[model samples]
Target: MARFFGWLFLIFLLGATYFWQPDFFQHSYSILKHGDIVSLAEYLRSFGAWSIVVTIILFIVMTFTIVFPFMILSGAAGIIYGLFWGVVISWTGEVIGAVVMFIFARYFFRQIIAGWITKSKYLKQVDDYSAANGFKALLIARLLPLAPSGIITAVAAISRISFKDFMLATIFGKLPPVIIKVLIGHDIVFAGENMTRLIVLVIVVIGVYVGLWWYKRHKDQNKVKY
Candidate 1:
C-alpha cells in the first residue's frame, strides 16, 4: 500500500507541476532563453525574506524536471548572493535534489532495472563497473559539463554502490562544477571583467578531461598486459 501510494504521489507531483504551472515555467524559460541573470535575481529577490528558500526549491524542482538548465539558476544565485553564498545555495539544493532522486529511483525502480541489466551483458558490465568504482566514476561524471546528472544518479542508484559512497561522491564531486558555474555566471553578468579567470577555468576543465583520458588509457593498457 505504501509503495503504491509512493509511486502514485510521484506521478501526481510531476503531472500536476507540469500541467498546472505553465505560467511559472514559461517565465523561467523566458529568463533562461534571454540569459537574463539580473532579471532572474530580481525575480527571486521579489520574494523578500523567502528568496533563498525559493531559490533552493527551484533547484530541487529543476533537478528532475529540467524545465530549464541548472546552469542558469546557479548563475542567478551568483548574481543574487555573490560567490560564497551562491555556491552554498546551489550546492545544497543540487545535492539534496540528487539524493532525493537517488532514493526514489533505488526504491521504485532498482528491481526492474536489475532484471533488465541481467538480460544485457553490456548493461551488466556497466553496472559492475559502477559498483566497483562508484565514487570515482560518479565524481568524474559530475565534473564533466556534458554528463547528465539525472542519468548518473539513476545509474548509481540501481548499481551495487553503497549509499555512503554515493553520498560522499556526490557531495564532493558536485562542488567544483557548482562553484565554477556560479563564478562563470557572475562573470557573464558583470561585463566580462573576469575574462582571465574564465580562461583559466576553461584550461582547468580541459586539464581534467586530459587527465581522465590518460588514466583510462593507462588502466586499459595494464588490463591488456594482465
Candidate 2:
C-alpha cells in the first residue's frame, strides 16, 4: 500500500513539473545545450533571496532527470556562491537527492531484485562482494565520477548495505568531485587565470584513478593465486 502511494507520488511530481513549468524545462535545456554557465548563474541570481533554495531544488531534480549534466549546476553554484558555500550547497542537494532515490529503490524494488540476483551465480557473487564491502565500493564509485549518480544510488540501494554505511560513504565520497568541479567551473569563468591550479587538480584526479586501477589489479591477482 505504502509502496504504491510512494510510486504514485513520484509520478505525480514528475508530471506536475513537466506540465506546470514547461518554460523552466525549456530554459534549462537551452542552458545545457549551449553549456552556458554564465547565463545559468545570472538566472539563479535573478531569484534574489530565493536563489540558494532554487539551486538546491534544481540539483535534486537533476538526479532523476537526465536532460542536463550535474556539473553545470554545480559550476553555477560556484559562480554564484564561491568555493566553500558552493560545495556545501551542492553537496547537500546531491546527498538529499541520492538518499531519496536510494530509499525508493530499496523499499520498492529490492525484493524483486533479490530473486533475479539469486538466479545468476555471477550476480550472486557480485552481491556478496557488495554486501561485504558496501562502503568501500560505494565510496570508490562516488569518487570516480564514471557512473551516473542515479545508477550508483540504485545499485547500492538494492544491495545488503546498511543505511549508515551508505550515508557515510556518500557524504565523504561526493566531497572531492564536487570541490573539483566547483574549482574548474570557477576558473573557467575567469578565463583560466588559475590555469596552474586547474592543471594540478587534473593531475591529482588522474593519480587517484591510477591508484584505484592498480589496487583492483593487485586484489584480482591475489584472488587468482588463492
Candidate 3:
C-alpha cells in the first residue's frame, strides 16, 4: 500500500511538472501583464483565493519528501493569490503535508531511521531529545522550520510520540511563520510600497531559525540521560 502510494505520487508529480510547467509560466506572465496597478491587485486578489486551493492540493500531493515542489507552488500561489490567501493556502498545505508524511514515515521508515540515527553522534542528541520530549522536539522542529520537516515527521512516526501530540505540535508550531509568509506573498502579489512587509518576512524567517536553533540547543542540554 505504501509503495503503491509512493509510486502513484511520484508518477503524478512528474506529470504535473512536465505538463503544468508551461501553463504555470503562462499564468505568471498573464497575471503580471494585467495592466495598471489597480487591475493587477484585483486580479491577484481573485487569484489568491484559487491559488490557496491549488496550493492545498499540491501540498497534499507533495507530502514532505522535497521542499522545492511546495516552494514553487507557494510562489505561484503568492503570485496569483497575493500574500494573504497565498500564505494561508501554502501554510495549510505544508501542515497537511507534514502530517501525511509523518504518518507515512512512521508506517514505512520508522525502524530503519531510528537505527540509523541512533548510530550518529551528532544526531544522538536529536535522538535523545526526540525520545524524551518527543512532542516538544517535533514542535520546536516544526516551529523553527529548519531541515525539511518531513524528516522530523518521519522521526516522529518512529518515535514513541503520541499521534495527538504530534498533530497538535505540528499544527501550532507551523502556524505563525506560515501565516507570515502567506501575508508576505499577499503583499508581494500586490506589489506596491510595502518594504515593511518584505523586511518583516526576512526577519521573521531568520528569527524563526534562530529560535529553533536555540530551542534545539536548550532541549539537547536539558535532555534526560539514557
Candidate 4:
C-alpha cells in the first residue's frame, strides 16, 4: 500500500539523517543543555544555507517524533538569526512541522494515534472537547504556551476538526508564544552583561513554567470531570 511506503520512506529518512550526522542527537541535546546557542548557531551557519536547511529538517523530524521542545529551538533560532529573521525562520519551520505531522496523523496514523491517546484520561477529555469545539478547543490548547504541541497535532488529526480550521488556529495560537521565546533568547544573550535583560529572562522562564503547571492542573481537573 502507499501508506506502507510512506512509513518506510520516513523511517529511511530518519535513519539516513542519523547515520549521516552521527552526533546529531547528542549535539541537539548539547544545544538544549548548554543553551550556548551562539556557538551552535555559529557552527550551523558556517555551512551557509545548508545550515537553515538542516535546522528545518531537524525541526520537522523533531516535531513528528517529539524529540525536542519547540521553545528550546525557538530560542536557538533567535540566537542564530536575530529577532526578525528568527521569528520568520522559526515560525516557518513550526508551521511546516505542524502541518506535516497533521497530514501524516490524519491520513496514515489516525487509528494508531487515536488508539494510543484513548489510553489517557486527559486525552479522552481532549477528544471529547475537540469533537464538540474542534477549532476552539485546539486553538486554546495551542495557546497554552507550553502544552505539548505534538499531542495536539495528533489529536487534531484524529478529531473531526477540519484541516483548514486546525492550521488557522495553529497560525494564531503558535505565533505569539514563539515570538516571546525568541525574545527570551535575545534577553538571555544580553543577560550576561545587562542586569535588566537577565531579570527579564528570569521572569519569562518562570512564567512559561508557571503557565505549563497551571495548564496541567486544569487538564487534570477536566480529566476528572470528563
Candidate 5:
C-alpha cells in the first residue's frame, strides 16, 4: 500500500515536471527579469522547502525502482532551487539512489552481465581498478562522468569493494561536476544572453581537456591488470 502510493506520487511528479518545463523556464525568467539578486535568492530559497519535500518524495520513488522520476526531480531541483541547493539536493538523492541500486544488484543480479557492459575492455579495466582502489576509482569515475555513478556503486558493491572507501570516494569524486554544473546554472540564470552560453561551453571544453591531461600523468596505472 505504501509502495503503491509512492509510485503514484512519482508519476504525478514526473508529469508535472516534464510537461511543465516551459512553465518552469518562464517562471524563472519572470523572477530574474523583475527581481534583483537578493530578491531572486530569497524567492528561490523559499522553494527550499518544496525542494526538500520533492527530494524525500523522489527518495521513495527511487526505492520503488523508478529511475526517471529521480532525473526529473533533479532537473526540477535546478529549476526551482536555483543551482546551489539544487546540486546539494540532487546529489543527496543520487547518492542514495546509487546505494539502493548497489544493494539491488548485489542481491538480485549477481551474475547477469547485461551483454552491453560485458563486451567492453575499458569497462573491464575500470572494474578491475574499482576492485583495487575501490573508492578512489569510484571517486574519479564519479568526478569525470566517465561512467554513471550508480553503475560504479553497483559494480563496486558486487565486487565487494569496501563500503568506507566507496562512500568517501563517491562523495569526493562527485563534488566537482556538481559544483561545475551549479555554477553553470547560476550563470545561465544571470547571463541573459547567448554569448554567455558560448563562453561557458568554451570554458567547459578547456576544463575537460585539462582534466584529461592531469589524469594521464597522475592516475595510478599499477592497480589494474592492464
Candidate 6:
C-alpha cells in the first residue's frame, strides 16, 4: 500500500511539473519584475474577501516549486497588502510550502534523493550534520541569505529532523529576511519623495550579499585547510 502510494505521488508530481512548469517558468518571475502591481492589486481587490485567499494559494504554488524562491513573492505580498499583512501571509504560505515539499521529498522521493545526495560530498555532509544538529543546522542556514530556501527544505527532509526543531528553526530563520523584503516592497509602493528608506533597503541587501560572499570564502578556506 505504501509503495503504491509512493508511485502514485511520484507520477502525479511528474505530470504536474511537466504540464504546469512551462507556463509558470515563462511568466511567474516576469510578473515580479515588470507587472504593474497597482493594477494587479486592483484586480485582486475586486475579488473582495477572496483576494487574500487567491494570493495565498498562488504564493504556496510558487514556493513549493522552489523556482523563484521566497523573495519574489515577499515583495509582491507587501505591495498588495502592506507590510504587516504581507508578512503574515508570506510567512504562512512559505511555511506550508516548505512543509509540503519536505514531506514529499522525504517520503515519495527518498530513494531518488538518496542516490543524488551520494553523488555530492557537500550535500552528504549537510545531511549528516543536520541529522546530528537539526535545529542549529537549519536555523543557521535559513538565517543566511546565502542559503536558498529550497536547499534548506531538501536537507531537512532528507535528514528527517524533528518537527519541533524544524518548525522552530524555520519560523525564526525565515522571519528577518521576510521582514526585510516586505518592508522594501511597502516603502516602494507608498513612496512619496522619501527615498531614504529605499536607500537603506538597498544597503541592507548589499550587506546581505557581501556577508554571504565573506562566509563562503571563509568556509571554502576551512575546507582547503582540512
For candidate 1, the per-residue lDDT at 179 reads 88
lDDT of 6 by residue, 195-223 (tens): 79878877988897898789899999999
Cα lDDT of model 2 overall?
A: 0.85
> Model 2 Cα displacement at 20 (Å)?
3.0
- Number of backbone collisions per candidate, in order? 0, 0, 6, 0, 0, 0
The digit string of per-residue lDDT tens for model 5 on 28-63 reads: 446444533344445445666574754544543443
> What lDDT tens digits, residue by residue, belong to model 2 across residues 53-142?
888878877886745667788889998998899999988988998898888889999988999999999989988988889999999899
Tens-place lDDT per residue, model 4, 11-118, is 898788789887866776677566576666666676686877877766786687675577667766777777798888887888889999999888886776688777
lDDT of 4 at 176: 75
- Model 6 RMSD to the real structure? 4.3
Error of 6 at 179 (Å): 0.6
The candidate scoring highest on lDDT is 2
- Name model 6 segments beyond 4 Å from true: 1-3, 6-36, 115-125, 145-147, 191-194, 216-226
lDDT of 3 at 177: 53
Runs off by more than 4 Å, candidate 1: 15-22, 214-226
Residue pairs in steric clash, candidate 4? none
Ranked candidates, highest TM-score first: 2, 1, 4, 6, 3, 5
Candidate 2 regions off by >4 Å?
A: 145-147, 217-226
In model 1, state the lDDT of residue 122.
Answer: 96
Ranking by lDDT: 2, 1, 4, 6, 3, 5
TM-score of model 4 (CA atoms): 0.76
State how far residue 176 of model 2 sits from its true place (Å).
1.5
Q: Once model 5 is optimally superposed onto the true structure by TM-score, how far is the C-alpha of residue 219 displaced, in angstroms?
A: 10
